[model samples]
Target: MEQNRCEKSTLLLSVVIGVALHGSYSTLFNPLTGPWSIFPLISLVLAVYCLYQRYLNQPMTDGMPKLIFSFFLLGLFGYNAYLKTSNPEMGSNFFSSVCIVIIAYGFIVKLNSVNVYVNRKKTLRKHRKQSNINCYQLLVVNTARF
Candidate 1:
């Protein structure tokens, strides 16, 4: 579980960094004439792969909402890719910023939600244990009184 979390966090960071850099330089560096267009292409392909995992593997998990986020980001990424290709001059930081922030915030929200769930389970277990002990004590006292 920890390993999966670390790997996911790393992947999200990489995508965010890539988006930010691509947005910043895609204009000045003129990515259209070069191979840099591959960034969005790769992103879209990975998004498809992610969708496959979301539905093809098995019943979805609690983390399935994160996949929704990836799908949303992937859709936007495709749009940005189209705009960049169609009208290179129209590209702006707005698209890249939104994508990067969505990924970043999604990663954070997923992690925090998992943590909260784990903590809640732990708390419930503790409460149950204490209640069990109290019940046992009450039984003992009633038996003594009888």
Candidate 2:
């Protein structure tokens, strides 16, 4: 159960990071725009919630962050691909940005998974030790009765 919770939290972290980065890029690339500003604001709220959950050592509630971010990325990619097809000059930038985002996303997921897995293993070891201690106590009591 704890392991499951940890995995969920880790997944949330990955989503938050991904969204936040995208939001940052949107704001940087297009300043003073109302729609682009919304992404960063939403990202900020989610980031705060993520930090609070981390501080409390609790799992984040499963939410729509991943779905929204995925859709945003897909839209961006489709738009870029369309642009590249129409104007070959932008093909290199489109591919490079896509490659960078993919690599970063992979790294974040892998790092979070390792951290969560390690914590889960440590908790499992602690639980096993506790069970072993109880068993030993039971054996001692039975031997004493005999």
Candidate 3:
């Protein structure tokens, strides 16, 4: 069914986001220490939760998970930009972080759009079913009058 396909696509998107988060963490924060280490861990946990939700056929309609990841990536991009400004040697990191941020933003937009589509489809189906039931009831009433 279309719903199943939507669920699968959402799951795939979540997996991609997870992989991207891991890549960003590895590339940008290798040997990360202090309180900064928690950011990636938080992202990882959110990704896992999102995946689990999708697996359960309860994909979040609010797009909160992707939004959170996008915000995290934006913060990372800002930090990298600041570091690059202070030390030109960090240019590569800054560039990579920028790329990651852009990619994450794109994915987030896509994921949210997909979620909206699924939701609309679900609502349409519900309305169709309701209308069918109403039609059936009307038919039954007319038949009874005979």
Candidate 4:
């Protein structure tokens, strides 16, 4: 059950980042000046929440500074995308930005997945450690009796 919770949180992290980065880029390359800022801001907020949860719930994964910084890239991507669809003023530059955003999003998702998997694996290691301690005590007791 705990593992499931961790996995779910990790996936949610990806979704929020994906949306936020797209939104952020829209603000940059897009001449429309529409809702591009919302993506990065929203993504940052979610990232903050994750950090808060990290401190409050697990307290183990204390290395998310990179994740926090990545939000900026996400915002850039979102703003670029927004410009492409809204204002044709940016021209082909917007399209190229769009490609950049897509590639960035993919890499972000992959990185996030690896971090989550490591977190869960760490949990398993603790459980294994406890079992090993118990087995060693049992073995010593049997040998003493013999």
RMSD of each: 6.9, 8.7, 8.9, 7.3
Give the alpha carbon lDDT tens digit for every residue of 24-140 in model 3. Answer: 565466443223445555666776676666658755546556554555555456555544565565445757566677867787788798889989999999999999999999999
Per-residue error at 146 for model 1, in Å? 1.4
Q: How do the residues 1-146 of candidate 1 rate in per-residue lDDT, one tens digit apiece?
A: 86566445444544454454444355447646445555655654664565456456545455555555564565447446655657757666567556756776776887798899999999999999999999999999999998
Assess every candidate by TM-score.
0.52, 0.37, 0.41, 0.41
Between candidates 2 and 4, which one is better according to TM-score?
4
- TM-score for candidate 3, please give it: 0.41
- Prediction 2 TM-score vs. true: 0.37
CA lDDT, every prediction?
0.61, 0.60, 0.63, 0.62
Model 4 reaches what TM-score against the true structure? 0.41
* Model 4, global lDDT: 0.62
Better candidate number, 1 or 4, judged by TM-score = 1
Best by TM-score: 1
The candidate with the higher lDDT, 1 or 3, is: 3
Task: Mark the regions of model 1 whose C-alpha exceeds 4 Å error after superposition.
Answer: 1-54, 63-68, 71-90
Worst 10 residues of 4 by lDDT: 59-68
Report the C-alpha lDDT of model 2 over 74-102, residue by residue, as the tens digit. 44454445445555644455574675478
Candidate 3 deviant stretches above 4 angstroms? 1-92
Error of 4 at 62 (Å): 4.2
